[model samples]
Target: MATQTYDVFQVIADPSRRQMLQLLSEDSLTINALASSFDMSRPAVSKHVKILHSAGFISIQDIGRERYCILNHDGFAEVQEWIDYFDAFWKSKLKKLEALLNEKTGSHKL
Candidate 1:
């Protein structure tokens, strides 16, 4: 599979970045509006936005003098596909464990 993959871990690793994502998911916000929600400085918040932008998770749209941060959901699929890979493995393992437990305990509705 010749697919380009971005490091979702690197994008989501910071707590501040994670919070920024959560807010972005809920609504498109300007840099000032976003900074108000946290105690961090404007430059610090801008840095986080820059990382998210570089990671392709966000894009800025100019609305008059303000630039709104829009969530680029396409980038989210990177994480989703990775999780899907693990989900299949865990689901099968869980089913097998459940079957083994039932065998040991006997299939009685106690």
Candidate 2:
């Protein structure tokens, strides 16, 4: 069977998945340990974990008999790049507005 692909944003769009990321942020966790934190069934949690893993947000490792989920930076880097672009865009616009306001008010305090 062919592997399925997932968009980073789409994978994180679900609240459960987002929470899973937050939980994993503190430390790596086994699949069962992670599932216990949620109200959903093990299969449901596993499904979300699979999506997160496929989207590059997480990596699963086999430690003896348990599978551990660890946070990965690859997916977050894409989101961060997008946010940084907008941050620069907004800063430029705000600087222009500040300059215009200073010119009109005859003050550069701001």
Candidate 3:
């Protein structure tokens, strides 16, 4: 059987996964602790955690007997860069539009 790989967008598309990210954003949590917060079985939550881990969204570390889930910024870098690119793109276009509007209004004479 082939293993399934998910992109950042696809991995974050699920509400449960997004919620898991939100929770981890606040603090690191154990698998059992995270599972208890959701209305799902431990295995089910493990599946989501596994996906998040595989996508670099979360990191799992063993502290004695408990495993902790922590949020990782590396996974979000791509999303952030993409948004920043578009933000800059729109800002440049809007500035050009504003200049054109001011020119038409003769507001630059002052």
Candidate of highest lDDT: 3
Candidate lDDT (C-alpha), each: 0.88, 0.91, 0.93
The alpha-carbon lDDT assigned to residue 34 of candidate 1 equals 97
| Per-model tally of clashing residue pairs | 0, 0, 0
Residue-level lDDT tens digits of model 2 in 4-53 = 77787788789999999999999999999999999999999989998899
Q: What TM-score, over all chains together, does every model reach?
A: 0.63, 0.66, 0.69
lDDT of 1 by residue, 77-101 (tens): 7789889999999999999999998
Ranking by lDDT: 3, 2, 1
lDDT for 3 (candidate 2) = 63
lDDT for model 1, please: 0.88
TM-score of 3: 0.69
Which 10-residue window in model 2 sums to the lowest lDDT?
A: 1-10
Against the true structure, candidate 2 reaches a TM-score of 0.66
Error of 1 at 110 (Å): 50
Query: Which candidate leads the pack in TM-score?
Result: 3
